[model samples]
Target: MTREARQEALERHGLVESGDGFTVTLKGFQKAAERARGLRAQGNQEAALMLALEPSDPVRWEYARCLQIDTFSTEAYESGF
Candidate 1:
């Protein structure tokens, strides 16, 4: 997906972009996911599933994927003939 789409996903999950314009706070997402996992381990299936289905996970994935790509120099990549 495009950067805009990925950013939109992050925004939908309440993750605001940092000053660098390419990063987002991940502590909250991590904590929530951890909590959900704990709940699942404790047999709270309903709550666990509810948390698991939240949009934060998708946003996290998108953010991670973005980080893995070399997006700093689009022009260089495009001109690499």
Candidate 2:
């Protein structure tokens, strides 16, 4: 999808743009994260984990790490830290 289409979907899904210009909404974030995981499950590992990330989240770095590990493993591993 185009950036504009993604933005429209986000808006239609009730994600609001914060002052910082990033989308912010718990429901939307969760949905995006879930979508990301589904992408992984469907063998779209890169797209899946990319969708799971929120730049402002403190856990973003960890999520990236998880993505790397997830790429190599058949089973998902939880971050211990």
Which has the greatest lDDT? 2
| Candidate 1 lDDT over residue span 1-81, tens digit each | 467766555554435556765443464355445555676789986545555565656754453334323232333246451
lDDT of 1 at 60: 46
lDDT string for model 2 (1-81, tens) is: 455755565454435555754443555545546656777788996755465556565565345434333432322122211
State in Å the error of residue 37, model 1: 0.3
TM-score, candidate number 2: 0.39
What are the models' TM-scores? 0.31, 0.39
Residue 81's lDDT within candidate 1 is 19
